[model samples]
Target: MGTAATDDAGSATRALIFALVALACGHMLSTLLRTIPAISLDLMAADFHIEPQALASLTSVYHFAFAAAQIPVGAAMDRFGVRPVSLALLAGTVFGAVASGFATGPESFAVGQLMLGVATSGMLMCPMTLAAKQLSAARFGLWSGAILSIGNIGMLLSSSPLAFVVDTWGWRAGFWISAAGGVVVALAVFALVPNQPAEHKDHSSPMAQMIEVLRLGLSRPLRGLIALALVSLASSLVLRGLWGGPWLMEIKGLTRVEAGNQLGAFTLAMIVGPLLIGMIDRRIGRRRQRGCREHSTDRRRHIERAGGGSLRRTDCALDDGGHGSVVAPRAGLVLSGRAFRRPSPAIAGDRCRRSDPQLHELLRFAGRRC
Candidate 1:
């Protein structure tokens, strides 16, 4: 048993290391592509003989494609696993970046940007999948934060190192370098990332999974979160991708290189914000727990006074006699007069009967909806 446990631990460690690598690669690819707009905006404007405002639309075009691809890519990862899908997307990155380097007109440039967006879409989901499958629940937050921080390093490099590369070899040449890096990372993913077992596999087809993701994304808390993410991302992209460069160039009267550096600083702040917020969340959660404990004690005293001393020690004692009180230790209270005891077998049976069909119908509807 000990040996088996040791082997499991070793396997988990290996998987985590590979996941970190995958995350790093994803970050690097995303940051590299993200920086391309900032780095190439001036060149694109000159090459296309368009105003900066028109050039800004190209950034929107890329983000539109990127955002659109995420759901489908996530579905594909769920159904097909990450390896082949990731490699294929990386190939798109390579093709798009290299091709964008040679584009002679705005149309071709926009098309190339779209292709890059589609490619980069894989980066957002695949790494997270790998991490979810490999890392322990306790380690997930740490690994996620670390992965994001590593990825943001690519954003940092994009400003300075990319600028240097562009200065030495021109902007088009810098893209060629990114294309080559994509190819290399794709190779690394193939070599290092472990294949997930087919247990409890998604029997749904790709189209079905896509539909389900869309449906789930629209439902309740998930919908609310998705809406928030979309709104936040839209505002962020507008500020960073569309306006950051122009704001620096026009408003601040800075050169492209200087503006890129300033934008890089903003990206760095984004990387830092998650960690800061996580710390705050932990502190707040602790404080809430303490407050909840105090409130529970106060409520228990009140319950004792009301001839319900039975509720004092029980974790989730439910009073069905019109008092409408359920007391939980750490979780929250459900203040209804209904009995909150564990369901009897008959009740469980009834619930299963009702829920199973509803669950099946929901899944079926989702499969059809998206």
Candidate 2:
């Protein structure tokens, strides 16, 4: 009987991991879609009768939309649960990707980008929330890294492979392919992610909840950290996903393939660097000081500060956006992974009584045994 029970537990763990990975692939799709314009900006601009820089700047709308939607998306996941929210987003992504592929004008493409931005804003959070609520902190930490590592793989695909596709079939092929991928991921989520509701639901109006988040974030004590996160996130996205290609191709006079290769190398480093820092963190048990000294770690993760917490506990932003852009993906998984230490005794009591679901959720992620 005992052996059979162990086998059952192992099977459940496997199923849970499959669901987690499928959800993580949504994060991959998010990165892939967001960065698509980087490689093909010139072509897209020419097709739309505009300057390449204009098209590049227009892509910023997507990022703005993405950032804005994260505020509501987290609440939706909390209220409606991750599985439903993920399915809805995946559906939107598929439609948006296909529409973008079919777009013949700048206006249509902009509309498509907006849809995609909102749809994919929570891709990382979906998986992160799932792991946070379902598993022990240790397992959640391991899986969090896995989520980052997997999600960034989309950037890798967007690099050389996407360049090749653009050269051969024109840039539209990328979106069509992504649409297909979205359908596949959606099916996987439907099949694998458990259909359970959130353990603690917040039934309050979303606007009130959002107001609470904004108020907390903008409060005097936390505003500095929020400002720092915003600065760090925007710079990294613009650097890696926007101008990096133009610099390589136009300024350096490299071929498209060559530029993709260069970006691929840098992205590979982006994927590997964080986990290395995280490992050193584990060994020495002192990452916060180093994180501050380097000024190149995850601000949100630092804010969490849970003892032995998962590496880079993040929320209300895209996964990569939550980390130090330089070393974002590389360190996510030795295998997969909060810095928010437990609340103070006074704050902890308030958290239990408050309807501010994020605070309640935050407290639940406190590091504990499986």
Candidate 3:
């Protein structure tokens, strides 16, 4: 039994690791799509005889489609598991990248962007769901951080490395390369990542769970967390998706290659941030635990002082006289039992007297008369 258990644990760990890697791949592809346009924005603008805003709209269309699909894609991930959904999305990404490379006008470019957005939506959620399902709670944080860091590398590559690819063989060549890579990653995910097992098949309807999620979000803490996440994500998206490349080219006056290199550095920093935060969290967690213990002790002491240096105990008593009393040992007083009696105090007193032999014997004649 022990050996079997160990083997099972090992299998689960391996699955979790693979899932993280697959998540990294998905993220890499998404980031690639995101960054490629920025690197080639100038070329795109000049080629299409449009202003920067028009070319930028192409990227925005992709973002809108990607963001819009998140909730539904999450639901699909819950129902069907990561493998099939991820594989399908990856295939879409490849097709979108290839199509975008060949697009001749703004309209065709927008269509490609929308397609890429729809396809890459799966990339964001599936790996996370897979990790949550397969990994132990203790390890989830580490794996999540690892996956995010790895995925950021894709963004990094999209910057400097993509610039190199474009510089060598032109922007079209870069897209073709990305499409080929996407296809390869998709194949890997299909081959290696585990899908939902029969025993763990989803029992609840997707609509029900989605509704529950909506309901839960109405609570204050959930709402707050969601709001905070949205704000942070908005800031990040604006910085990376909109401003990063422009800042490099316009403000820094760097060539596309030099600008891409600068953008790569920014992406590298993003990749490193999670790792640094993880390490800080680990270190701070230990300190936080100790602080919590000390705080608990201080709270206990404060409570003791508030009660005159002694803890108070309260007790209820029912006497033979058919009376109930609330006795506070610290206060040295007993509350009248009238409030506790369901019927008349007289009736309760008589019953209490009858039930207690010591009190009954002491007032036997009186009891008999009653």
Using lDDT as the measure, the top candidate is: 2
What local distance difference test score does each model get? 0.62, 0.73, 0.65
How do these models rank on TM-score, best leading?
A: 2, 1, 3
Minimum summed lDDT over a 10-residue window in model 1 is located at 333-342
**Rank list by lDDT:** 2, 3, 1
TM values, all candidates: 0.72, 0.80, 0.71
Q: Is candidate 1 or candidate 2 better by TM-score?
A: 2
List clashing residue pairs in candidate 3: 320-353, 321-349, 322-348, 322-349
lDDT of 3 at 34: 76
Alpha carbon lDDT of residue 252, candidate 2?
78
Model 3 scores a C-alpha lDDT of 0.65
In angstroms, what RMSD does candidate 2 have relative to the true structure?
A: 9.3
Residue-level lDDT of model 1, residues 1-370, one tens digit each, is 9999999989878876875677578667777777666655776688789886787876677778988998888777766677777888888989998878887878888888889888888785666566655544335545556566666666676665666666677778767888888888888888887666532246678787678767755644233334334433543455555566666778679876787788788778867865553344433544324434544664564355344356544424433343322233112322211112222343243453464433222222211111
